[model samples]
Structure formats: structure tokens, C-alpha cells
Target: MTRCRLCGSTALESVVDLGATPPCESFLAAERLDAPEPTYPLHLRVCTDCWLAQIPPLITPEETFSEYAYFSSYSSSWVEHARVFVEDAAARLGLGEDSFVVEVASNDGYLLRHVVDRGVRCLGVEPSVNVGAAAREAGVPTLTAFLSPETGAAVRAEHGPADLVVANNVYAHIPDVIGFTKGLRALVADDGWVSVEVQHLLTLIEENQYDTIYHEHFQYYTVASAIRALASGGLTLVDVELLPTHGGSLRLWARPEEAAGEPGRRVADVLAREKAAGLQELSGYTEFSARVAKVRRDLLRFLVDAAEEGRTVVGYGAPGKGNTLLNHCGIRPDLLPYTVDRNPYKHGRYTPGTRIPVLPPERIAADRPDYVLVLPWNLRAELVEQLAYVHEWGGRLVFPIPELSIVEVER
Candidate 1:
């Protein structure tokens, strides 16, 4: 934390300190609820030299991803998103039966299944034993191991060089940014491509998406910083695409330095936008802490008002970001009572720090709560359609991020 993870500099400045909280994915079993739960300081800092926003590496990936709770196939929209990405990537890259595709941190084979359907040889490198088993059961070849330079080279040696390496939503998960990037470089063919999708720091600050910050997410990236990080691993950013997923994200297309030519105009355009937003300097981050504080205050006020007025408020989706929001706002079961998710892995378990009960999706309809707080706001469109049935019982949906707003769903 004292030195930049990407750049070896000691000019890191405070971004926001979210206080102490347990690992966001550490759901408590009924029996383990009595045991002591550990928490770590959730502070974010940006290196002035490289502008890479990061948190301390307090916890290891082995502790969290060894047996992950999240299953990407649980959400129909995310599955469809993966399917579309696979189809487009195959067409764009002219991938065929001869092309070999590999996805790092591939959870439950959600994306690789599409690659398999296309008759393309593919493999999933996942760290989680349980979810990796699920992927293998679904007919996707998966290797249960973490992604390191050694792991990457081993995969290439055994399976041969991959034509396309897809790493979605995992660029920020590792603490060793340079090492992870080098692993990515080693996985793909010398002339092949690597596509990485990560949440953009631009939207995280502008949209008040502070809940995405957690112990597992070691660093956040802007296109400017991302360019530097990619080069550290001997990969060059050739193209960039702005995506709507995860509130906002960047899909960076890269390749081995020798094969990478001039970066596309989109890369320059996005970097221009980041600069215009003042992310490269101190001006962009100066107001983020204050904005985050206001969000916490506003959400707490609404929850308190609802309780006093005798309105029943429950939560939807037991996502990791929800844990950050709950713990940061100091919300307890009394305020939230219970939350529901489609992922049965979390049912009957309690949120790590808030200790809110996670139930099945049917519980919301059966209980008929007056309001359902939507936790995974990034999936707003998908959840809105799924929860439209709440209108049958006069239940409205609540979103707490990007400012608190209540929406009435139509049947």
C-alpha cells in the first residue's frame, strides 16, 4: 500500500476510506455465525505517478476464490451477455473449429459454453473448485487453478497456444497487476489477441458506484493507467470499447508487444474522455469522497424513515457489492430484514458483516414486502423485468446508488 502496485512509486494519495469490513463474499453459515468474523480496512488510494487506484492486498485470492459463492449462469442476462460476446468475438476474430479459446477466471463456464457450441476448442481456467466442477459438468473443459505466469505457461504447453484469450471482469481482482498481465501475455499465441473487460474508474467516480470497492478488487483502472499496466506485462493496448456492463466498463483489446501495431482511435478517444474528466490529475478524485459520504447518508435516511413509518423494506440480490453497501452504511437486519437471490448457494446463509438473511427469490413474493431494495443496481434492467411481478402486491423497487430513487414497477 505504501508503494504503487503497478508503478514502484511512493506518491499514493487517499481516495476514500470506507472503514473496516469483512470480505464481501464471506457469507456466514448458520453454525458459523457465532464465530468471530475478521474485518480489514477498506481504503482506496491512487498513485500520483501512475494514477492506478488500488486498495491494500489484505486478503489473498486463495482465501476467497478457493470456493466461490458467485455463479455467473444464475443470471439469465449475464448468460446472454456472454453468449453474444462469444458470437461476436468468434465472428470478429474469424474463429473456427481450429481456433482455440481460453478464458481466465471463467466462472461456471457461462462464456466458454458458447465457444464450445461454436465447435471451437476452448478451456476455462478457474480457481474455484465448486464452480469449476459445475463448468466441467456442463461439458466445458476446465482447469482448477489460479492464473499466474507459471500457470499460464503450463496451459499453453499442454493445450497449445490459444488464439483468443478472454478475461472479463477479473483485471482488478489480482494484487500483482504486472504478474497477472504477464500471465495473460503467456496464455495467448504470439500473434493472438487478449480481450479484458474491467470496470472503468471514470464511471465508478461519476456514477457514485463506490460499492464496487472491496478487498478482492485490488485495483481500479482508467484507460491511461490501463495502457501503462498492459505495457508492464509486455502487451500493448490496440483497441478499447466502452461497455454498459457493471454500470460502465472497458473492453481492452491487446496483444504481444511485437505483434501489436498502432492502437485504435477508440483507445485515444477514451483516454481523451478520461483526461477531460480530470482523472489523470487530482481534480477528478477530489469530490468523490464527499459524494460517497452523501450517498451513505441519503440511503440511511430513507431506510430510517421507512422503518419509522411502518413500511416493510426488504432487499433483492445478495451480491458482493451489496455487502460493501450494507457494511459501509452500517445497515443491519433490522433495517433490511432479509434479502433474496436466485443463487441457492447463498440461501439460508447470512451476509458477512451485516448478517442479513439471504432467502430464495420466491420469499419476496410470498412475504409481500412493501418495498424491495435492489442491491445489484448494475443489473437494473434485468432485475426490473424479473421483479415486475412485485407490482401485483403494490410493492415498489428501490435503488440506493447514483443517488437514492424509488421506482414503481408495472405488472
Candidate 2:
């Protein structure tokens, strides 16, 4: 992009160019295998002026989320995480049966179900028609719409202002950052809290989690840039917490400027950590491209060697991040014959660009593949436990991001 999406400055520098890849979630059907798939530039750049890392908004959210493929309830660990967050939020905010909560991008009612059980009234604003239907089936009062300024205002007017607004793992999906933030302000009460959970740019660089970069994720944030983004919408950062989900993420607490007092010491401490990691300057990003290249090389070498040795290697999950890694490394079915996922929607589909077949999780046990490459490595602990049966067949698990490592499972 010519100018920074957040600051509107022309001082953007390259962090990494992952070449071109299709929209990661665009799985292919057998009937459409012969049709040409479209791709877009997967380049990430950091703005020297605002320190916000972003990609060109080549794809729109409507194209990706209208009939979303990802169903959040598939991951048991994530659902439990949401449950804990709801319990803690209710206690922290003194929420009761009379309190109201709103969650943006609430996928499949995975989180709001916990809110519903607490006897507190809640609503979910989601764009995808299918997932919204699923949420309604689960008894979550959901409005099928994207969160813009108008939608937020309408929800507030009808339901009254929310006592707490929770937006988890969706801050990076929207191209219009300022407008989305304004919508957040309009939904929340003047004194109510707004909690946003997003992947931290600091952990992304330090851990070499380049696979998470994709077209749907238009921007990345550090606490410093997040403060600026929140300010643009009349919201102020009040407290910060480090979370281990999605490799590493930030849970930022914000409020309207009128009620947002001085930011807590945790916010300043995290800012100091970011500055120490060189995220506020150019030096932090200079070596990321090289590290990303090393990850690509190591993964390809292992897959090729496995194929040459007549040892089968299949993928564990067909997540969006896995598509980026597979497409970037130029892996086809020859290296990874097929992958399996718990989501039934992807059971008979093929991964975008790579065209590798996706099967059910039972296939791993049925086929007894020599190695199962774990794509959604962020859920390592949960998958390791679930796939422990692989040890029965002397199968091992492989993780690609943060470094390439193969682990032996104990039955």
C-alpha cells in the first residue's frame, strides 16, 4: 500500500513479502478443481510514523465472512477459554441478571453461550449468515450484521448500552480500523468497559509466527499503535494483560475518554517491553524476513525427506494459517498427501492453492501416517492430548511455526 492504513503516512517499510496466495479460507470443491484460483499479494509493511504493521486490503471482510468456514466451537480449548473469560468478566465488572453484554464477531455462539448461562442478557453481532443461524440455534440473541457505526448505534438504541463489550481476535480483520473502533464506542456505555483481544506484534516478531499473516488480517498492533487507534474513536486504553492464546495476544481494556482515567502501570510496562524489543523502530523488523525464510526452508526439507524415505506425512488441521505456510513453501499433495480437520464443512474440500485433500480426524488413526504435521500449532497442548493415540502406531507430531520440531507422543 502507498500509505499506512492507520496513520495515512508514506513511510512504510517491508517486514516480509510471503509472495502471493489465495484467500486462506477459500477451500476448493472437487467440481471446481480445474477452475483457476485467484491470489493476492501477502506483503506486510510497518509504518515508521505510526508503527502499525499492515497488509494491502486486497480482499474484503464480506467476501471472507459471509458464509464463514471457521466454527469456533470445534476447538474445545478455545471454548473453555471463552468460558473462563465470561466468568471472570462477570465477577470483575459486577455483572448480574440485570446486566447486558455484547460481543462483536461472535462466531457460532462459542463464547456468548457462557454469558447466556449466567442469566445475564447478551447479544452477538456477527456478519456470517450460517454462523449467525448456528448462534441463534444455540439461544444467543444475535443480529446478522457487520459492526459499523450505524449497526452499533442501532443495537445500543434497541437494547440499551452494553455493560461490557467483548471483541476477541477480530480487531485485525477490518480494513477500516477507525470506523470499527467508533462502532465499539457507540455500542458500549460511557462508563462501561471494552475488552479487545488481538495478536501482539511483539510476540509475532519474537516467535517467528509469520504463518498467521494473511489477507483477512489487514493490520497488526503493538500497544503503542493500539493506543493511537483507540484514541481515534474516543476510547482510551485503561489496562493491559498478556494472554497465551493464538501463540501470544494482548487483552486491552478501554473506555470512553470521559471515564477512562490514567492508564494502569501494566500498560506502561508492556510499552517498555515493546520498545525494548525494538517494535517502535525499524531495527526490530530488519531480521524477521530472514527468520521467516529459515522456517520455510526447515519445514520443506523435512517434508521432502519424509516423502523420499517412503514415510507418509499428513497435516493435522486445515486452518487459514496452515494455508499460508503450505502455499508459501510451495507444498502440494506430493509432500503432504492430505490433512484432516474436525470441521465437517471442510471434510470433502481441498485447501486453497495447494489443493491438498481434507479428510476427517479419524483418517489419521485409520491410515497410520508416519508423521502428522500440526498446522494450528497454537493449540499444541490440546491437540497433543487428543492425538495421543498416534503413539500407538509409532506416529509423531510436527509443528512448523516458532521453529520446526517433531515430538514423540507417549500413550
Candidate 3:
């Protein structure tokens, strides 16, 4: 980029190439029956100063989320994750009915419901109309617009500055990284801090999570890089926490410049770790593309080999992450005949780039394919339990990421 999205630093290094892939959420609709599928270069970069992992801009927030498709409630594990976060945050923030809370990119009110249940005043800033409506139905005060400096001012004038701001996994979703952080500064109270959770860039490299590189996840954040980004908006890093969830993420707390309280030791420790890991230098990113390519070769080899033998393989979960995986690996109906999902919105629709038919998950038992691929491997436990019936027919579940494995069920 011209300057680092996180720090405005001009020094950046090109890292892994996810190759060209379609936008993860561009699921084929009836209107696209005869239309051509579009794919853009899916690549990631690392900041020499901030160590933030990021992708070159191919789309905008308005274009990416105007008709959003992902819904949080569809993932049982994520819902439980949200519940736990709600409980812990309530205790930590000591929030009560009068304290206002806001969550940007509040998909379907999965997290805000707990705040509402606690009788706390809360609002959800969601750009997608469909998801915004879902939050409204769930009793959250929903602001159906993209959060910007102007929008944040309007929201503050009406709803007042938030006592707490929670942005889960959405910190990387904004194209205007600087603008969004500035808006965050405007929306939060003078002393109130904003906690943002983003997938750790180091983990993405170590675990070979190239599939996370989709159109929406515009700017990835590392603590070193995030500090610079936050500072651009008159905010300072207050504390940082390492979260095991989402394959290792960082929960960073930040407040305006004049806010009191020293930066936590975690911030310094993580920064040191990144430096030791060479995140402050450009060479750290150069080797990632080879690792990603290896993953692609291995996964494609396994799937295509199974297909050639006439051993049918079906997939589970229509997550955006899965879409990126499918597209980057060039997986289509040949290697994987079809996939299934729990979300009614995605059911009966095809996965965006792969064109893999998305049926109701119940179809798995109906067809009893030789191998059931778990697309969203994060929910392996629930998926295996729900599909335990496969054991009766000598069927097995296959998970290809982090490492390829077969979940064999006893007869």
C-alpha cells in the first residue's frame, strides 16, 4: 500500500499470495444465472513498522457488506463463544443498565443480546440491512449504517458516547482503517476504552490459515501495528490480551490520548515477541507464500485423488472462510460434489466461488457420502457429534486444515 493501513508507515513487505479468488460472500443468486464469475488477486502484506498483516484493496466496505450473507447464529460454537464473551465482559467492564455499549459489525446481535438481557443500554452498528434487522428483532438498538466519522457523530448525538465498545473480529473488515479508528475515537466516551479482537497475524502464518484472506478482511492488525493505527486517531493502547479463540487472536483495549492508566505489560511483551519473530523486518513475510502453496497442493491432492476413485466427498458449513479455502484451492463440484449448512439464508444457495451446492445438513445422512469434509473445522466437536450417525454406515469425516485428518467413528 502507499502507507501502512495500521500505522500510515510507508514501509511494507509483500508476503503470501492467496492467488486470485472471488469475494467470499458473492454467493451465486438467481440473478447471476448466466453471469460471469469474477475473481480478484487475493494477496497479503506485512507492515515493516507495525507487523500488521493486510491485503491490497480490491473492494470497498459499501461494495463488500451492502448485501452481507454471513450470520453468526448459524455457528453454534460462535454463539457459545459470544455467550462466554458477554459474561466475561459484563464482569470486567462492570456495565449496568445506564452504561451504553455499542458493537460495530454486530452481525445478527449474537453478542449484544447478552448486554440487552442485562438491562444495559446497547446499540449495534451494522451496515447490512438483513443483519441489522436481525439485531433489531433480537431487541438490540440497531444503527443500520456503516460506522464513519460523520455517522459516529450522529450516533453520539443521539445515543450518546458509549461507555464500552466491543468489536469482535471486525477490526480487519474495514477498508478505511484510519477512518474507522478515528470513528472509534469519536464514538467511545472520553475515558471509555474500545476492545477490538482480530485474528493474530503470527497465528495465521504458523497455522497456514491462508483461507482467511477474503475481500472483507481488509486490514489485519498486530499489536505493534495497531498501536500506530490507534495513535493516528488520538487513541492509545491501554491493555492487550491474548485470546485462544479464533485460532489465536488479540483483544486490544484502547482509549483517547488524555485517558489515564499505563499501557499493560502484555502490550510490551507481545511487541517483544513480534520483534524476536522478526515482524519488525520485511523478511518475515517472504517465506509465507511457499507455506501457503504447500497447503494448497496437499489439500488439492487429497480431494482430487478421492474424486478420481469415485469416492464421493461432501462438505459441511458454508462459512466465508470455507469459501476462501475452496476458491484458493480451486475446489469445485468435481472434487467435492456438494456441501451443507444450517443457515436457511445459505441453504439452497451455492457457495460463492466454488459453485458447490449448499444443501441442508440433514442431506449428509440422506446421501451418506464416503467422506464428509468439515469446512468449518473450528466446530469439529459439534459437527462430529451431530453427524455421529455416519458411524452406522462406516462413513468418515475429513478435516483438511491446520493438518489433514480423518475422524473415524466406531461401529
Candidate 4:
């Protein structure tokens, strides 16, 4: 049995098993489709001791992120989210030209550009050469190395301890959660703050967001477990904000343990809500696996019905979560003949396990498929609006997560 990654507890209980899946981000080129793809067991386990939901790191960060495919700037909604975060964080931190800011896992300078535009000095630490080079090309100062205690110390030495440290959506991707948190401790100034955002585990279970579970994300965190994990690295959680991004995420605010601080009302409120939702106990997770199983059945039934009725279905957005959902449900090009993505890198590539060909979004209009399956259901609103022209042909959008539903488009 794999011990809990966060707390190292022996009492790890299975929450949900996604079975064997390939690295979600490994989009295959036409030539590589015949090559044998490696797959790893994707199972979520919760530690009874600490209630930290985690998955073993079957794949290394180098294999997953070094030459990454997903670019944050591809999604305009995500870029806007980053821009808004930078604006709000800068004002809240009282940032200035002298204030040094560092963003860990800064993907393609999507957020840091806003920081630099405001005259705040910032550095981005990105492990992926592809995205890091893009960040550099975009004029955001970037280091092509994973953030660790060693790298964080080097960053502090050369750039000075950061007045503000931002880590968005990378907290769960880290295998060494404690080491990453310690690096955050090393990177931030004494009076400064570290803001980390992760998809909230509570939301994952409630919304049947098992699609987010892949080899890349090593752990899922709730308020209680996140506070515990952060404390292990000499940081203290002082505040938290529930964000609507990435399904649902928690923006955690922390300072060094020496700082005298009390948990804010928001923190207490969320904790209370988590506790009320039974996040503190093992029994709360008992029904999760069954719920996740239902999603697979629901989605497959919908797709099979569409095919039987001679309806053509295509997909939008080739995200990692979409790949997971597709692979787990045993979907292939037969049900979803092809998909579309805006990222040029993924345009010619096929989805990891399902081998569904990905094309450009313009093809959707040209082909005019009867139903467009919105794979990235979290961004359903944005996708619906972006592909609203499909409604002109009496086509509607379909969502496959939480529950399978057909989106009603206003004609």
C-alpha cells in the first residue's frame, strides 16, 4: 500500500480509483500514435490520520512538465483570471517598483505580465522550457527550473526575498508538498505573504470532479489539510478565499510562523463549512466512488445514444481533465470523432489515451457537427459563448461532468 504522500500515514483509505491512465498532458503526434504509451494507476487515497487526500507520484515532474504542452495563455478566460489576480494582489500587498515579486510555476507569463506592467519587479520560476521560453519572449523574467528549497534560496539570494510570492494552481501538481511549501517559506519576506491556489478537494467530491485526478496532480487539499500541510513547512495559514476558477479553488494566504496572526473570519467560515460537509471524517468519502462511477455511465449513455440516433458529436478544448474523463470512460474517436483546441501545439496532436484527433476550432463551423461536446465543462460558459455560432445551425452544446446535460442555446 502506498503511504500517504502528505502525512506519511499508513492508514490510507481508497476514495476513488480511476484505473490506469496515461499522463494526461501527453498529447500524441500522428507518428507516435502507434508507439506504446505508458500508463500508471490513478487512485485517490485519504489518510485517516490527517484526512489529506493524495495520489502517489508514479511519474516525475521532469516527465510531466519539462516539455509541457498546455499553455495558460491559450484560454482567454484563464488569462483574464490571472490578470485580475495580479491586479488584486498587487494592491492588497501595496506593491511598488521596489517590491520584488516571484511567481512559482508561472506559465507563459500569463499573470506576471500584469505585475511588470504595474512597475512591480517580479521573477517567474517555470520548469517547462517551452512555456518558460514563451515567458522570456514575452519579456517576463523567468528561470527555467522547478521551484525547490535550493532554487528558492538561489532566487532569494539573487533577487532578494520576495515582498509577495504567488503560486496559482501548482500546489497540487507538486509531489514533494512539504518541500514546495518550505521553498515558499524561503522565498517570501518576513512581513510578506505567500498566496497559493489549489482546486478545493471538497468541491472535487461534491461536484464529481474526478476528471481533475491525473498523474500530474499528486494531492487534493481541503482547508484543514492545506493548513496542516503548510504548517509542516514552517508557514501558517492566515486567510483563505474560495475562488470559482478551475471548477473551485482555494486561495490560501500564509505568513511565517513567527508572525503573530489569527485565522481570519473567512478561514473560520470555510473550515466550518468543510467540517459541516464531513471533510474531517473517513465516512464522508464512502459514497464518492459510487458517484464518480455514475458519471462514467451517464456520459457513456449520452454519447452512445447520440451515435445511435445518427447524430454527429465533436468536442471542444483538449484539456488534461478532458483527457482523463475521456480515457476513464473508454471513449474513442468512434463516439467523439474529433475535438478542437485553440493552442497551436495541441492542434495537430491527438488526445493521450482516447486517440481522438484534435483540430482547430474553425473546423467545428466548417464541419457543423450536430452536437459539440464541451469537454472542459468547468469552462462551459466561456466555451458556449465562444462557440455560440453553432446555434445558428440548430446545434447545441453538451456537458459530461457532474451530470450529463445538453446546454440549451438561444436561437
Candidate 5:
């Protein structure tokens, strides 16, 4: 009876199920640890109709994002990524102080601050008050509300239609994918361009990235599903770029359906690549569940072996995706001991489900653990570079995703 969230197709087949798990971002304070915690079925389904892979909307946006603990400014590489994006986008779009820019889900103004610094008029629509307040403090104008058709209309009325609309990493987080795209269509001027960044489904399947399947990420889009969803909302995909961030992601450029422009060759080329890779068929999804199960077994074995050998192991980056991997593999503080993050808001709070203590990065060198299990495998390069000092003690790094590999960092 369950239908696909995007295309409303009842021909939904289970691809990968992570069993019952808590919301990935539900980091718990000491007082809440003693109280009952809730967990939901973290199962993914693929639609035969449109090839859109998604999870049921079991949780609301307010419950998942209203008062968030994640801040994008904490990651040095991610902040630099934002800066580069703004610089490139500004140059490409011919943006200036006279042009208006708006970014949805602009956490902590990590991206918009760069837009403002370039002297472009920018505004951020962020629902999380904690991050929104931080954005305001950083001199970025922000609204503490989720973006929908209604809010998009209000923004258009107040500031006129934006020349550039940015929604990076928010496409997967939104429950109503069609509505969100429609809102983008409404808010963007006919000549304006909309940019959306999402982790490509092909990489998630091909690389055994099941950790990205938590409740907050309701949709995992392929090129086909993304095109269909965007077209449904009167928007058209014009260009596409493959990025290495977040394992692998797609940066799609869109325009109003009525706008006059030719779709870039990258669009057809990407679609052809996806189709050849078997994204349009069920076989591409069938082998995923087995691959995901293998990852869990291998990770558990590695952790158990490390514990039996009496070697110290700790985690780096308490990201939401990390919580999913930790909880799905049934790892607790005993196996992980403690994890470190740069976000001060998450410090002193324990990770959801696994209950691993979140400490400051300074603790990593103080303890000098034998191994640092990197939870955020997508940011492995940045983290590996940041923790290169661990090599001073003959310590190594561990990545749980794609496969379990213990790597040594050379100083």
C-alpha cells in the first residue's frame, strides 16, 4: 500500500533496509539520555515508475530540523567549498550588488556569507533557529522558516524574484520534492538559474554508502528521477556537473520551464551514463541490499577485533550519517569509546542511538588513540589531513564505508 513519495507509484520495491534506528541528528543531552528515545524503520524503496529511490516520510521537518545541532561552518574544507562555489557562480551568472541571491537551507550562512562578501545582495532561508541566529551574527540576513511554495511567494513579493537560487544538499532533506522544486520555480525570475546539489544515487549504490540513508534524507535521486521531478514542477534541467564532495554528488543547473535556453550536452550525456549504468532497471538495486549487509558485518568484525586486541579506537566527526553507520552496526561507546567534532554545539552531547561521548578535537591528541575511526568517510581527505599529527604516535585511520580499510597517514 505504500507509494513512492515522488511519483506515487505503488510498485515500490525494498532496496536496502537498515532496520529500526533513531533520527541521525537526534544527539542527546545528559538529561534526555535517561528518557525513552524513539527509533523509526530506516528502509529505502525504489519506484519502478520513475526510478526515484526514497524513504517514507515517517518524520516531519519540524521534528528533524527545527532546532538543529549541525553547523556547516565547522568543517574547514566544506567552508572552502562554499567559498569556491560562490566565486564560480558569481562569475558565471554575472552576479553583482544589483542582483539578488537566495539560498535555501543555508546553514550558518556558510555559503551566503561568501555571496555577501562579493558585494552581492543575498538572503538565507533557514528553519533551524540556532543556525539562523549564527548566520545573522555573521552579517548574513536570514529567515528562520522552512522554504515552501508559500514562503517562496512571500520572499518574491518582498525582495522581488531572485536572480540566483541555491539549494545545495537540501534536495535530499526535503520531504516534498515536487513542492520544493515548484517553490524554486516560483521564486526564481524567468532568467534566473537554480542550482541544486545532491549525492548521486549511482555512487551510493556502487560504493555501498548505506550510511547516507537516514531519516533526514527522504529522497535519493538519480538523473532520471531528478529530471522528472523538476519537470513536474515546471522547471527544466539545463546543465549538470559531477562533484567529488559527499562521496559523489551532482550539481544540477535548472531554469524555469518557460524560459528560452538550450539544455547543455552534459544533461543528455549524464542521462545516457545513468541509463547505461542500469539506473532505470531493478537489477541495479537488487544487489545493493546484500552489499550493504556485508558492510555491516565487516565493520562489526573490525571493531570487535580492535576491542579484543586491547587497542584504543576513537571516532572523528559526529555527523548524522556517522550516527546511522554506528547505530546500524550496533556499535556503542564501548567499541567506539568517544568521538570528536569541531562543532561546539555537539560537544558534551552524546551521539544518538550509540551514545558515544562527543568531545573536542583536542582530545584526539591528548589520548593519542591507536586508531581513529573516521565516521564521516565522505570527508576522509579533509579529516585525514587535519589529523595527520596522529601519525606522530604511529596511529592510523579507519574508514567504515565502501569497505573497512585501515590507512596510515604520513606526516
Candidate 6:
């Protein structure tokens, strides 16, 4: 039995089983094709004690993102989101040139660059070699090493404490989940803020976003689970926000007890809403799994039928979520001929495990495929506008998950 990583509770039950899938970032080299791919079980289980949902131990952070391939600057939406976050964070916290800021797992300095733009004293601690290097190139001072209790001590030893510590979408990646948050508490100043963004478990289940169930994303979080973990580490939740990025996400802010900062009514309200939505209960999980399975079944049927009708199909956005959706749905060259990515680094490479080729966006514009699959369904509206020319050819875009639907040309 795989015990819960956060709470160490052995009384756990399977919530969703996505069978086996290749690591979302395992985009293989051409020569490596035909070699057996490592397929690991992608099952999410919730601990009876803490109600934390997590995948069983399979992939390590050392293997997942030690040398990362995905760069945060590559996504326009993400970069814009970072800019908005920087502004809002500064406004809310009264941050300015005098305040010191730090970010953990700060990929490519997306948010830190914005901090620097505001003339604040900021540094980024990024463990990934490629991502950290890019941040340095952009004049964002960064330390390249995995964050641990020791690393946190080292950071405190060098720079003392920070006024603001930002950790975006990284709250779920660490398996030593409790240890990681404890490290955060040690690094932030007594009255400083630590803000963390994680995809919300409530949104994932409600939206049937099973594609978010990759090995790298070990734990799915709710406000209740987050509070339980943070309070154990001596930090208190101060505020929370629900974001639309990454299908759905929650931004949580924390500080020490000596600061005497209590969680806001919004945080409690959301937690109460979570319980009211049945997330604290068991039936919500089982029913969510069933709904996610139906999405898979329906997606496969639609793809197979589209093939029979001889309709051309391609994909948009070579995102990690897209890889999860494609790999879980067992889609390959037969159904999706190729996927167009804005990131040139990913354009020529094959998607992990599925081996569907990634090409530039110009390919879609030139080929005018009959049907384009918007894999990053959350950004479907943005993609539709960018590729509106397809409508000129009477082409439509297909969204697989949530439901199998199509968008036709307005004119």
C-alpha cells in the first residue's frame, strides 16, 4: 500500500486510476524510438486522515526536472499572467524598492523579472540547470540547486530572510511535501509573506481534468489540505485566491504565527465551499474518477470516428498537460498527425511516448488541416483567435476533454 506523503496515513483508498503513462516530459529523441518506454502507474489515492490526493511514488524530482526542457518564458499566456501577479503582489503587499523578494523553483525568472522591473531587491532559487541558466542570462540573479532544509539554511546564511517568497505551481511537485514547506518557513522573514500557487483539486475533479494526473504532479491540493500541511510547519494561511491558469489553481499566502496573521474569511469560505462540494467526503472522488473515465472513452470514440470520416486532425500547444491528455487517451500519429507548438525547442521533437511530431505554428497555417485539436483546452479561446485563418478553409477546432466539441468559422 502506498501511504500518503503529506500525512503518512496508511488508511488510503484509490480515488482515480489512469492506468500507466509515460512521463509527461519524456519527449524522446528520434534514435531512442523503438526502445521500450518506461510506463508507470498513474493512480491517485486520497489519505483518509488529511484528505490529500496524490499519485504513488514512481518518478523523482531528480529524474523529472533536474535539467528541465520546458521554459516558462515560452508561454505568452504564462508570461502575461506572471506580469499580472507581480503587479497585484506588489500592490497588495506594499512591495517596492526597499523590500526583498525571493522565489523557489523560479523557472526562467518569469515573475522575478517583473520584480526587478519594479526596482525591488529579488533573487530566484531555481534547481533546473537549463531554466536557471536562462534566468541568469536575462540578468535575473539565480541560485541553481535543489531546495531543502539545508538549502534553506544556506540561503538564510547568505541573504537572511525575504520579504516575499513566491512559489508558483511547485507546491505539488515535491514528495517530501512537509519538509519543503518547513524550508519555506525558515527562509521567509518573521512578518514576510510566502505565496504558493497550486492547481486546486476541487477544480480538477469538477472539470474532469484527468490530464493533470502526471507523475511529476504527485499531489493535488485543496485549501484544507494546504492549511493542514502549512500549519504543521508553523506557518499560517493568510489569504487565498482562485486563478484560471492551468485549468484551475489556488494561490495561497502564508506567514509565521509570531506575525499573528490569521487566515482571511475568503480562505475559510473557500474551504467551506470545498466541503460543501463534497471534496472532504469520499463520493466526490469516486464520482470524479468515473466522470474522467467517461471523458477518455468519449475522446477515443471521437478520434476513431474522425479517422473513419477521413478528417484531418492536428494539435495545438505542446504543453505538459497536452502530453498527459494524449498519452492517457492513447492518441498517436493515426489520430493526431502532428502538434503545432509556439516553442521552437519543442517544434521538431516528438511528444513523449506517443511520438506524435511537434511542428511550428506555421505548419498549421500552411497545411490548413480539416480539424485542429486544441490540446490546451483552457486556452482554447486564445488559440482559436490566433488560428482563425483555419475558418477561412471551413476548418473547425476539436476539444477532446470536458467534451468532444467543435468550433466552426464565424463567417
Q: Which candidate has the highest lDDT of all? A: 2
Candidate 3 residue-wise lDDT, 1-411, digit = tens:
677766677877788777788888877865675788888888777767667777878888888787788888877778888888878887888888789999999989998988888899998999999988988988888888988888888889999999888888888998787788888888999988798888887677677777777888987667788888788778899899887766678998898889847898889999887777766777666777888788788888888898789888899888888998898888988898889888888766788777888888789888889999888876777788887888988889988777778889663
Q: What is the model-wide C-alpha lDDT for candidate 6? A: 0.86
Model 1: colliding residue pairs = none
Global local distance difference test of model 3? 0.83
Q: Candidates' lDDT values, in order?
A: 0.95, 0.96, 0.83, 0.91, 0.91, 0.86
Global CA lDDT of candidate 4, please?
Answer: 0.91
- In TM-score terms, candidate 4 sits at 0.99
Candidate 6, 81-112: lDDT as tens digits: 99999999899899987898989999899889
Candidate 5 residue lDDT tens string, 166-253: 9999999988888888888878998889999999999999999999999999999888899898887888899999999999999999
- lDDT minimum window of 10 residues, candidate 3: 26-35
TM-score of each candidate structure, all chains considered together: 0.99, 0.99, 0.95, 0.99, 0.98, 0.97
TM-score of 6: 0.97
lDDT of model 1 at position 17: 98
Task: State the lDDT of candidate 4 residue by residue for 156-238, as single tens digits.
Answer: 99989998899998999999999999999999988889999999998999999999999999999999999999998889999
Off by over 4 Å in 2: none
Q: Model 2: what TM-score?
A: 0.99
lDDT (10s digit) by residue, model 1, range 300-325:
99999999999999999999999999
lDDT for predicted candidate 5 compared with the true structure: 0.91
The residue ranges of model 5 lying beyond 4 angstroms of the native Cα positions read none
lDDT of 4 at 164: 88
Q: List the residue pairs that clash in candidate 4.
A: none
